[model samples]
Target: LTFDDCNKSDRAFVAGVLRKHGFGATFYVTEGLGFLRNKENYVTWEEIVELDRMGFEIGNHTRTHPHMPGLSPGEMRKELLHIEKRCKEHGIQKPTTFCYPGFGHSLSCVRELQRLNYLFARRGVGPEFKDGGRGGRGPAYDPGVDHPLLVPTTGYAGPDWKMKDLMWAVDQAREGRIAVLCYHGVPAREHPWVNCNPEDFRKHMDYLGEKNCTVISMSDLSLFVDPRKGPEDPYAPIRARMKREK
Candidate 1:
């Protein structure tokens, strides 16, 4: 999945490309940075509605995209809950997944998200969440990490970057491990650090398709290990069967 800042033009362009390829993604909305909400540098509410109508999941990023680790617990609550309320007002129900601003969060942030009943609370895919090592410094590719919650994503920085590291992720997906590729832009024209052009994205998507894998929302991934199940699953048989089918 990817997020475009207050770039309405970028939103439409990227969404169009994903739809063209029959792939869906999530756009984590930052309320305060919205186009109509913030006329300076972000996408408009109408653009968000347009993408929502197109079957892309609209998730909560935050009100201002502040670093959660920097906020007090109450402030973090406001950032998480207020944006959630705003999403519902815009007709987005159960906005359960959140992308931490700059991958910043504290345990208090986790409590706040859980209090709000978020199902998928995650940072980027990386070693910190994976093997308990820290994630990437910038958007550099670091293969094979462990944590699902702090899912370390190999930023496909356009087509060239796609050629370099997108395969590592696709390989994991084929092995039944969830591969979450996070990106900053569809065309890495502005932010080369975590940007990727559409052609590269298409090639990457094509690779996933070739693996006979399904592209799913974070919600689908959450169902894999429902906290309520508490490790020893009462539903393991059913899930295992489904996995085998896949």
Candidate 2:
């Protein structure tokens, strides 16, 4: 799920790539940015509506894209709920997923999201397993979190750097783990904060296809894991058998 700070010009570009491969993406929109203001750095609200019409889920990322974890309770509430409202205002009702800006979340962020009835939130960390691999890298992961509201993501940014991240995710999924990729803009524009080239994006998608991993959004993953157990279930047996102190 991607297209952070997207613009109208690249909407079709990103959409075409994914559609060609029989996959779709969910775009989390930042309020009042980009095409909404008709600015030089974003896609239009019309374009977002079009994407929504094209089987893509439009989620919220707060208006003005602030870090809620740092804000006061009142400010955090204002930051997230207001955006959630705007998403509804634009016909994206019942938006269930949210991504904190810069992966920033706090007790306040979680509370506010819960208040707004968000079912899942995406974080930026994964479990640490010493799976056999090259030069000290570890094993992949499976989803189903202790906190269903907080999910993890594997982001792919540069074509070169992305291949490694993709391989890691594929490895984990092959071992029956879940890999949710957190990514940003497409078509390679300014702002390193929101820049990913088209070709680079394709590499990650191609990897998913080749690896045969079911590409899905955060909510889809929740349904994959057994709620009775949690994210820690997969590693439970291993943890007990390995009694040697680290």
Candidate 3:
């Protein structure tokens, strides 16, 4: 499981609930989305440190959360480096995992992440699964088939996501496949499109706990798969899937 943005609820509400269930998750932090000016909606750097101390992985979501495809390579590097510098200042480990802001990604961004030595990077479900707009569904991460830098989100819990959608995502986690779920704030006020109610979030967590699912943070994937290994052609799996589907 992964929570995106620097939502204040991450420390206040989400962490406590996950602790209760003994589940591990990643919190992708960024100063973007008015995080610096808005204390009510976003978390402070100190709160982010507290999250790291709680043993949760703090992944990079860039500094400004720009549409990655539009940024020049140099611009992208700056956005990523700013977050890395901040994490170090707060004593958080240099993030080995990254999530594309707005789910906007490109081949250049993937190569950039690789250059920075990111072990894993998460992208929203797309191409493989026709994007259903906000909170879309997509295929599970098959390490053998998909590039580590192009890890696909199995489910994104936005307003449209329900218990049924959650069930479908988890059900896909079997054999050699892993389901990766993305979520914004629990009751994301500013971003209504990606908002997930606290009650609904709890229900989803409870379901995962009840079913004995092995929930893990994005960085935890290194335990099972070597980040150094991936398809020689990073886009090969995507093209293959697209062709097969067609």
Cα lDDT, all candidates: 0.58, 0.59, 0.92
Candidate 3 worst ten-residue window by lDDT: 127-136
**Candidate 1 lDDT tens digits, 1-246:** 556353553465777766756776777777653434544445667777777788887778888878788899888888777767877777876577778876665567766776777766556533222312221221222122232334435443433453546665565553445566666556544345555566666676777677765666666565464533222322233244346656
Number of the predicted model whose TM-score against the real structure is largest: 3
Clashes of each: 16, 6, 0
TM-score per candidate: 0.74, 0.77, 0.98
The CA lDDT at 18 in model 2 is: 71
Error of 2 at 228 (Å): 10
For model 3, residues 1-246, the per-residue Cα lDDT tens digits are 999998889999999999999999999999999798999999999999999999999999999999999999999999999999999998999999999998899999999998999999999898789776668788899988899999999999886778899999999998899999999989787888888999999999999999999999999999988999999888898899888988
Tens digit per residue, CA lDDT, model 2, 1-246? 545545543476777777777775667777644435655567766777777787777777777777666788788777777767766767766567777765566666766776777767665443333322111223333443335445545443433344676677566555455556656656445455445667777887887777665666555555666433444333343243344324
Q: Tell me the deviation in Å of residue 38 in model 3.
A: 0.5
Clashes of 1: 16
Q: Candidate 2: which pairs clash?
A: 6-43, 7-42, 7-43, 8-43, 142-177, 142-178
Clashing residue pairs found in predicted model 3: none
